[model samples]
Target: MIKATHRPKHSSIPLLALLLCGLGILALGTGAVRMSPAEVVQALLGPHDETQARILYELRLPRILVGALCGALFAASGAILQGVVRNPLASPDIVGVAAGAGLAAVVNLMLLPNTPAWLLPVGASAGALAAFGLVYVLARQSGEVLPIRLALIGVAVEASLDGLRRLILVRADDSIAQALIFLSGTVYGADWERLFRVLPFAAVLIPITLLLHRRLDVLSFGDETAKSLGMRLEPARLVALALAAGLAAVAVMGVGILGFVGLIAPHAARLLVGPRFGLLLPASMLLGALLVVAADALGRGLIPPIEIPAGLLTTLVGAPYFLYLMRKTGRVR
Candidate 1:
């Protein structure tokens, strides 16, 4: 009986590792022109035929890398926010963070036509900060912020900004098609340069999160308990929120709003690994990366010659799962 109990625990790590490797192989192999797993492995290791080399290096690698980064960032951000609020439903997308970044990018494209590509992410970060600031101010009461109120305020703000974005698109002189595609969240145009732009922020933020993992775990308890445990409640909350927001903003700026990834991935990881943030965060990142990569592969391969947006595929899969979770949690307000 003891051995049976230990067997599952002992096997989980290897199982997870195997799953990740399989997903990575599948991601590399299942793109537009299907490549065998052996071909994919060969392409990565050394020079292949010119066509295979170009496809592997120029096309698939960037998309896979960016997809992984975006997924991991979103999942980490979601894990942080959910921990902060102690609510399973609290994700960056649901809290106006992605909308804020999206609105900023849209405005920059429409109003500041001459702005450099690099500055677009800067604008996105600024907009995300502004939205969070607004939510913080509006949700504060007697020097304490309520999580539920913050979420509600975020929903309202996101709705308002989304309306404004549509209005801007309607009146703009240029084609709204590109903007629409972007808003749906895709890595179709991701290249090395854009990947490089997002990598630094992810590098910085993810490590900081790992360092603060213990504090996050503590904060998951009720506020009073966390304070009694020597956590400075407001300051810690603010710092976590900042990290989560920055991660979300950078992700949105890099590849429009990918919904449900942040929420679903973290929650799923929590179920698999338990509630300790130290384990949960990294697990969430890995699972999140896997999900997005797999979804991207599905989007590219589902129809011959035609592609669906990764965001749409995620929404179709994620929304129903989210609803099921909400029902299970009985936390609907």
Candidate 2:
């Protein structure tokens, strides 16, 4: 645990929020028919130019919101899981949460092709919880979930789920292209529908996540210490797992398995804000939002005609960081 003395005061919180807003503005201005910040604000407030207003209101704003919210939710989910598992390495992607959601989504789309659009997020959330539940049950020994056990079990389960997902995708043939959107994690052609779909989940889960920070703090204190503090170990872990899975699933519903936002954002926030969950939760959210929005901006701006998937760019950065983390922690401290 990070000592209180090492925890910086709350000064960094506002700074990260400011940076996220600035990045959001810059991201809004990116892409063809680029507008300056002044123009972006003007378009947002009231459209002097019809085309500009349409683009801002219909296209860019919702895309940015989805991307930023997904990033924040993923970060929060990862933070919760890390505390639950008591390992820096635990995240939605790494711990079978994303894979579980992906598999459920694939099954929903491929098998039940005409599945109601409204059921997609629900299916994803259920899948995420089921996968983590499998991991939890398998990883526990003598009613305790050790960090090493959970990480190892998670890796095994993630691999199995991803492998199954790939096989189904290959068989789907015509659906392969469409599946890539969720599998590869792109926000391209994002619209108001997705933003609206995601908003209620965000409104509910994000606050619940913040409220659970103290619970997370307790979970991180190890089984014995946490028990001494009146925390009921098993039930608490189950609730936290469900919350984390829901956050990650809802996030990927729009963005499709964004790599490492879950892992990297919380870790970076931990460096700045210390291991305290209360401060760590919000800081991770802001940094995660900034990361996705910035990555989306760069991806869009890097090439005019072709849009790189935000997941690809994040993976490019996150994969190396993941390696460094593994090396530094030797399967996490």
Best by lDDT: 2
**RMSD to truth, every model:** 3.5, 2.2
Write one digit per residue (lDDT tens) for candidate 1, span 130-211.
7777777777788877777778888998889878877887887564345446657887877888899889988888899999
| Local accuracy of candidate 2 as per-residue lDDT tens digits, 1-333 | 445586465999999998989888889999877889999998888647999888888989999998999999999988888877777778886567888887888888876777776576567767877888888889889987777788899899999998998888777868544644655787787788988888898999989888888888888888888899999888887788778878888887768788999999998898898888889999999988888888888888888757888999988989898889889898444
Which ten residues in a row are the worst by lDDT in model 1? Answer: 1-10
Cα displacement (Å) at residue 214, model 1: 0.9
What do the candidate models score in CA lDDT, each in turn?
A: 0.80, 0.83
Model 1 bad stretches (over 4 Å): 1-17, 114-122, 331-333
Instruction: Give candidate 2's error at residue 320 in angstroms.
Output: 1.6
Candidate number of the best TM-score: 2
Q: How many Å off is the CA of 14 in candidate 1?
A: 5.7
Output candidate 2 Cα RMSD: 2.2
For model 1, state the Cα shift of residue 2 in Å.
Answer: 23
Global local distance difference test of model 2: 0.83
